[model samples]
Target: MIFGTCGQRAPSVGESAPAERRKYIEEHFRCISDCDMCGICAVYHNQDPLLVYRDYIEGTRTFEEITEEYRR
Candidate 1:
């Protein structure tokens, strides 16, 4: 799924995703040194970006569903 300000495709979550998926999620979605170019910090505000996307990364929920929670 495509998420965050970078517009990169997120790694697909599968029924048996390996632990590396977590690293991929963190590296891609979490805040890096270049915060000005990434909008995730603003979207998550004081929340941890990893926590915000936990369900999706765990394959327990869709990215859309998690994002919809914030939209509401």
Candidate 2:
């Protein structure tokens, strides 16, 4: 089973993750600069940021459609 930045997001039904498992997984992502938490997180606190604003602007486009939208 492949997992990356977006893959491990499970829907919140109050199923608390095990402490060690959560720590292990969260450790995979690292800060790019001297700070932790990305820019959107530091400024707007957008905990749930999408991959692109264009995805929302295009309105209900399928993943393939969104992928094609960026290809131009």
Candidate 3:
């Protein structure tokens, strides 16, 4: 099984994520500059950094989407 950013297997493309997991990720992750704890492109969408990275790698999501939705 392929584990996703959230430490669990990822769902197929276009599949909706679980609400609870999504909520947890939202509460815990934040995209910001001037920080380098994990060293991954996670400065948009206010989504889980790991998830963002995973999505990016999988080609399911794009940097543009993150910028358009979360970047201020």
Candidate 4:
């Protein structure tokens, strides 16, 4: 249950693999319907967008660093 560059399906590749490797992958960027983005995600929703904008212009942030801050 993994993907690689160009949305390629993982775990089925080698020099001897079949040429039709693309068929093994059904979709790209699957969504999790059960995810409601509550709790911690809610906190991010409240504050992180502004931080993200600041990061873009102010050159003082990164998504991973801010996300790790929220996790802590």
Of 2 and 3, the candidate ahead on TM-score is 3
**Candidate 2 per-residue C-alpha lDDT over 1-72 given as tens digits, one digit per residue, 9 for 90 to 100:** 223255663222134334433342344333455445455345324332243322333333333343344446
> Roughly what TM-score does model 2 have, to 2 decimal places?
0.24
- Candidate 1: count of backbone clashes, pairs at least 3 residues apart or interchain: 0
Between prediction 1 and prediction 4, the one with superior TM-score is 1
lDDT of 3 by residue, 9-66 (tens): 4343455455533543444454446456643354543455656545533546643454
Rank by TM-score (best first): 1, 4, 3, 2
Q: Which candidate would rank higher by lDDT, 1 or 2? A: 1
Q: Which parts of model 4 have CA positions greater than 4 angstroms off?
A: 1-41
Q: Which candidate leads in lDDT? A: 1
* Model 2 poorest 10 in a row by lDDT: 9-18
Model 2 ranges off by over 4 Å: 5-17, 34-72
Clashing residue pairs in candidate 1 (N, C-alpha, C atoms within 3 angstroms):
none
lDDT of 4 by residue, 1-72 (tens): 433224553333332133223222212212234447434235455543443334422334433344456555
lDDT of each: 0.67, 0.37, 0.46, 0.36
